[model samples]
Target: MTAAAALIEAARALDALGFMPSKSGNLSVRTGRGYLITPAALPYAETTAADLVEVDLGGAVLAGHRRPSSEWRMHAAIYAARPEAGAVVHTHSPCATALACARQGLPPFHYMIAVGGGGDIRCSGYATFGTEALAEACVAALEGRRAALLANHGAVAIGRTLAGARTLAMEVENLARQYLALRAAGLAPVLLDEAELAAVFEQFDGYGRLG
Candidate 1:
């Protein structure tokens, strides 16, 4: 699929999965020079490929009819910091958002935690959404990871493609549910240690990822 078409489909898929409520998330893909991102405040169900906006690293809107996502700063800063991040997904996914509201980071309680390029998914310090400060906090928290939770906000995931990013976002929400389940059962999570996690990472590297 074309980049614009793929992006639009990804957004709608996330929305169908209930990650987005009242248009509370955004998706973007790197465009060599800048990036193509979802428009701000538009319901994903109502968005079309033509609605996606392209923006520069310097915050200029290069193309599209609707305004770029307010969190374009987060997308631009992440692209600037990690050249390998070809796509980014941000969502107010329910389970993940609940954890983020509590300022909780996802630790290595499960092997899937390593899927995010780290032993844990850090929760960034709270900041108002859409501002440079929020972007700075996100960049800092995601320094060595592919995903993070924005405190009192939601979750973010980056990957080499939009599908991969979307999958990572889904995994984050799944893990969040697992974590909450453990806590609800009055059981403390027994996290995998660094050595074990490193081995898992090696295994992942050796196996070609499907998504």
Candidate 2:
């Protein structure tokens, strides 16, 4: 599919998953010239491919009439910091965003943690949107993982494709939901031990072979 088609497809999928509630999320994919991203303040369910705004790697708009999402600074920072990233997805999924606002990083509570690079996802310190501080914090938190949460904001996921990023975002939220449910049941989460986590990281290349 074309880059534009991919952006719209991702937006719709995230909307269906209830990840993009009421213009609360942003999605973007890398393109040959730069990136095409969702416009700010628009509901994801109503967004068409034509609503996408084109911006260069430096976060300067190259084309399109609409304003880029205010979070484009964070997206641009991720692309700059991690060349492997082909897409970035930010969502305000309930449980995950709640954890973020609580200023807590996810613990290694399940094997699904492996999906985010075999450890707990990190939560960056809070920063104002569209600020350099916010972009820098996001980049720092996402160092070796496919995803991270922004304190008091939402979660961000990056991957080599838009599908992969979207999948990671969904998985992160699912994990958070499970964690919250388990807690509500008065059961302490059985976090994976550091040794086991290290082993998973070491064998991650083999795990990647499954696909």
Please give the lDDT score for candidate 1.
Answer: 0.94
lDDT measured at residue 20 in model 1 versus the true structure, 0 to 100 = 91
Candidate 2 residue pairs in clash (backbone atoms < 3 Å):
none
Per-prediction TM-score, please? 0.97, 0.93
Q: Rate the local accuracy (lDDT) of all candidates.
A: 0.94, 0.86
Give the per-residue lDDT of model 2 (tens digit) for 149-178.
899988999889898898899989999899
Cα lDDT for residue 115, candidate 1: 86
Strongest candidate by lDDT:
1
lDDT of 2: 0.86
TM-score of 1: 0.97
Q: Give the range where candidate 2 is weakest over 10 consecutive residues by summed lDDT.
A: 202-211
**lDDT by residue for model 1 (96-153), tens:** 9999999999999998998888899999999999999999999999999999999999
